[model samples]
Target: MSKKKKIAILGCGWVGNALKTKMEEQGHEVNCLCRDINMDSLVGFYNCDALIIAVPPSDEYLDVIEDVYFSVSLNEAINTQMILLSSLSFYDNDKLIADAEELAKIKDENTVILRLGELMGYDRIAGENTAGKMTNDSTTNYVHRDDVIGVIEIIIDKNVRNKIFNVVAPIQSTKKEIFTQNSKKFNFKEPSFSNIIDKNNSYSSDILCDVLGYKFQKENVQDFWS
Candidate 1:
């Protein structure tokens, strides 16, 4: 077993809270920092072995990073490994990419960035949000909540750093395929596809698998209802 270490997760939302439970299950102490909590509380978690920033993108995100850096500096926790949970939007969204790059500047050699695909699992499924507004033929890039947690565990376990990985399932299914399957399984209304040919936004996780030697527990987004 890997040695137990102290971990801190900022932003205890869906992904962050789930990660906290998984880390605690593995016998590591976890500190959860939610948005409602004061940023000053970051001081207490600065000494942890790892600091995971899983907050979604927003105007307040950079402010959170600033506070975290200030607290880290005050505590002089130079060895604290930092991980930023970014999104695949970084491929097209300049602002989000800039935010991720800012986080990477914190500790170049000690930080890892994961640009996640569409987050799916539990209540968040394919075709639920974009129902009648999307093209049926466009390819999907999705990653399950379990796989996200799984990849983070491998990074912490192996002490992987100084890399940015695309955290997506290996499979690429079309919107029609996923929506059709989901409608049948979950009894949701099938999404209507537009006649317009939209650009495929498929992303690959080759670097993640190659570097970490990690296998996804939930490889198919179409099968991720639970």
Candidate 2:
């Protein structure tokens, strides 16, 4: 039997809440902390076996990290492994990319940073959400919510650390192709694409899979709607 762990998630939002439920189902004790909750609650939380920072990128996120670092430092006996949830969208913004770089420097040897691809699962269908808002010419770099949770569980179970991995599906499909499929399958409106090409590169999950020997449950973004 796998050893039970006490895990603390810093954000109880969509992704975080789902992860909490999964961990609980696996028999791990989980403590969820959100911005609305008292910060004092974190004092004891810092002593957990692992900490998953699922808070989205923002000034408030930085503040949360600063507080966590300070509290962790104070407790010399604490060796809580940290798993920072980042995103591939950061590549589109210089500031977000810089912020991700800065985060990698924190507890460098102990922190495992996961730069996830565009999240797609449940009600968050790439085709449906991107319809009428943007062009569908660029390649998609989506990762299912199940994969995200699975990767985290693998990391904690194997005690993986000091690594940076892109948590995206190995398959790359054009937005237009995915949208067209969704439109036929779900009766969604077909989205238009711009003639202007997107130069952004597609993200690869090779390192994540190669190292963890993990196989994505939902590898095709086109099938994400189902």
Candidate 3:
């Protein structure tokens, strides 16, 4: 029988909470870190074994590292392994590699960094940056939230560690292709086509299945709706 591991999650919002519930369902003791002091009720649940950071992308995120908050949060459980839920936003084609590297520099060497791409959903972000820019002529990576959590579970089961990996669909699809697919499913107007790289930076990852043995839930990303 496998021993149950204790897990601590920082910034347990939508994705973080999902991970916590998933891990707990697998018999692991889970703890969460939140900004609010009223969350003290959760402190009794998790001491530490593995720390999973689910914070969003932001300039101030690096400040968490400088503060050694993660390292100190676990207190006596300092030897815990870490899984940083980072984003492709940090990958500014090596320009931000320094910051990216810093985020994974926990005290332990068993840390794994999973950098995700633009997630596609019908939620608020759907109408924001990506949805507005998607075109039949444009090709990009979009991973679903369910797929994101699934890949993480797969990694935990295999005990993959000490590397950087991209959690994206295998096939790249344009915005129009995805939207059209969704429109067909939901019966909406066929979105127009355009070519635009809104962000000044372009980031890409090559090692996912090569190192971690993680295949995304979907092969074709052509059906994603942003």
Model 2 CA lDDT for position 175: 78
* The 10-residue segment with the lowest total lDDT in model 2: 34-43
Q: Is candidate 1 or candidate 3 better by lDDT?
A: 1
Clash count for candidate 1 is 0
Least accurate 10 contiguous residues by lDDT in model 1? 34-43
Which lDDT tens digits does candidate 3 get at residues 10-108?
A: 778778777888888889887786654335424543346666777775676666544434445546644566677777765555444456456566554
Compared with the true structure, all predictions reach lDDT values of 0.80, 0.80, 0.63
Give the per-residue lDDT of model 1 (tens digit) for 1-226.
6899889898899999999999999999998865544453534666778889888777777877767655655656357778888888888766956665666676444678898998988877777666545554678899999999999999999888788899999976887888878877777777777676568678999989998999988887766874
**Model 3, residue 95: what's the lDDT?**
41
Tens digits of per-residue lDDT, candidate 2, 59-147, equal 56666677666665665786788888988766777586557557655545578888888887887766786655657387788899999
Q: What is every candidate's alpha-carbon RMSD to the true fold?
A: 2.3, 2.2, 4.2
TM-score of each: 0.90, 0.90, 0.74
Candidate 1: which pairs clash? none
Candidate 3 regions off by >4 Å? Answer: 36-46, 68-70, 73-78, 93-100, 106-109, 121-137, 195-206, 223-226
* Residue 144 accuracy (lDDT) in model 1: 94
- After TM-score superposition, the amount by which residue 65's alpha carbon in candidate 3 deviates from its true location, in angstroms, is 3.5
